[model samples]
Target: MKAATFFDGIGWREGVVELVDGGARLRDEVPATGIPRLDGVVVGGFTDHHVHLQLVDHSQLACSRLGRVVDLGGDPDVVQRLAVHPVRIEFAGAFLAAPGGYPSDRAWAPDGSVREIADADAAAAAVTEMAEAGASCIKVTSNSVAGPVFTDELLRTVVELAADRGLLVVAHAEGAGESERVIRLGAARLAHAPFTERLDDDQIARQSASASWISTLAIHDDPARAVAIDNVRRFHTAGGTVLYGTDLGNGPMPVDLSPREIAALREAGLDDAALLRALSPVDPLDPDSNLLLLPGSSPAAADPLAARPLTPADLKV
Candidate 1:
């Protein structure tokens, strides 16, 4: 319950956190539980901002250290079932795209997982359907690399519809000009840091000012990796919100916190605090009921990947 370093919302400090009624309370003194000493720092549970619940095993994810997840794309029915799982889930029902667009033909994307908007007039209805299905946000695909993308008019309609519904919009922006197009259309977030093209300073500044970009750095292994890293580095330096995400289930990756992804963010100039902020749960969701306990004196700052998420059951009174 005591930690030499504790993340007290603002920063890490020497303090003790007491477990109470499935929540954590910071206190100066607390009775020991007769348990062995835990020489690590404690912090709030981590959230992966982008994942696909339908593509990955929900049970495996719940057992991992991640205490929360934001599923960017999935089938409505399947994703809805996961909402009641142990780990907190904030999901976007499905990938809204043009007919025959990205993920529609992919083997991993199931039927009913990709809703195609053929007309701009249907944009509002599409968003409403997802909202009815319990989607916290709306996800769109603007990936020209795969197939036809939404026309500007349709994209604008989707964004406007989501805004009217009080929902944030996230887009999978790929191919040249896609990132800028998504930002210009007023989407609230990007599924991945723009990797298909290197964003110039102006573009970086504009994207940073307009939308948060999820860091899926570990998904790329070729030359695109450098471009993504540089873009994210500049985006973070420009004060943009960089969320931690691992496009999980897109490839072979760890179900839990990914050390490669964490290291990649670190390489992109996100110091400990910035990295933790990316991992921290977003608002509208209650603070994580669990706590993260590491095994060391907590470095100058916390290494997110090193911390172990602990539930109330894992803690001894």
Candidate 2:
């Protein structure tokens, strides 16, 4: 089928994409299937890097434009079951926190979703349980504002254990000193961009060099929102990897691609190319499985997020 125009995450071009078994490839020529001409640009499907499947209606998410999602924290058994759904999912089985830590007492957390480590000695075992349960990464909490947090030693142990298993560690770091601890402990990613406080330049550079920050910028409001936007902007300027992740299911937010979240990322200083890269999946995540065909000419290069997402079935010749 011919797409009048298309943007393959790099630039705009006109081409006929041959869809094969849920994947697509650009071709020079092909026999017309008598399918009506497609107008507008086609691009890769997007991924929401942070979400809680246990809290949202999974069916609604499956029907949305999102091609894949990374479940940050959820009940292991429930997450495992949902992983088999049509919308691809990469998940961290549960939230590993210090005993009585954040989310343990929260009304939203499901049973068996938050495992509190009793001591540093149990760090390895706890991480192993998550990996064995098919978790893509280990998620740990370092939210000092909520309650008790993992000591440096315990946090270090958890990171090491995850590393040993060839998995990365994503941390929910909030409150004072939490970001510093996450950096010092060598976590590979921050579940949310640093909020609650403005980070100094050196701290921002250090964190940027060490870990990628998921842009949950739309989740914050007003003063705190400005702080996060500044931190992310500096981090991006310092050559940090900014990933697009809306904390879906955490509050009243869109189950699919959030235009507000995209706008926030742009406000955080990400250009069109950077925004595309953030939304595109990396190796093993499979962004090619589905295509986002946007009607009309490509959206302003700087605001590609304004385009809607369309599935392969919607564009199949």
TM-score top scorer: 1
Give per-residue lDDT, candidate 1, residue 160: 89
Q: Candidate 2 lDDT, tens digit per residue, 54-109? A: 88887786567677799999988788877433468889988998899998989999
Q: How far off is residue 166 in model 2, in Å?
A: 0.6
Q: Tell me, by lDDT, which candidate is best.
A: 1
Prediction-by-prediction clash tally: 0, 0
Give the Cα error of residue 16 in candidate 1, in Å: 4.2
**Mind giving the per-residue lDDT tens digits that candidate 1 earns over 1-317?**
54335665456555455566765544444335553444667765678888887777767865677878888888888788764344788899989999999989898887788898899666777899999998899999999998999999889889888888789899999999999998898898999999999999999999888899999999998699999999999999999999999999888888889989998999999977788788873221134445667657464756776777544544454
Residue 248 displacement (Å), model 2: 0.8
Off by over 4 Å in 1: 1-5, 8-10, 13-16, 19-38, 83-85, 281-288, 311-317
lDDT of 1: 0.80
- How many clashes in candidate 2? 0
| Superposition TM-score, candidate 2 onto the true structure | 0.87
- Model 1 scores worst on lDDT over the 10 consecutive residues at 281-290
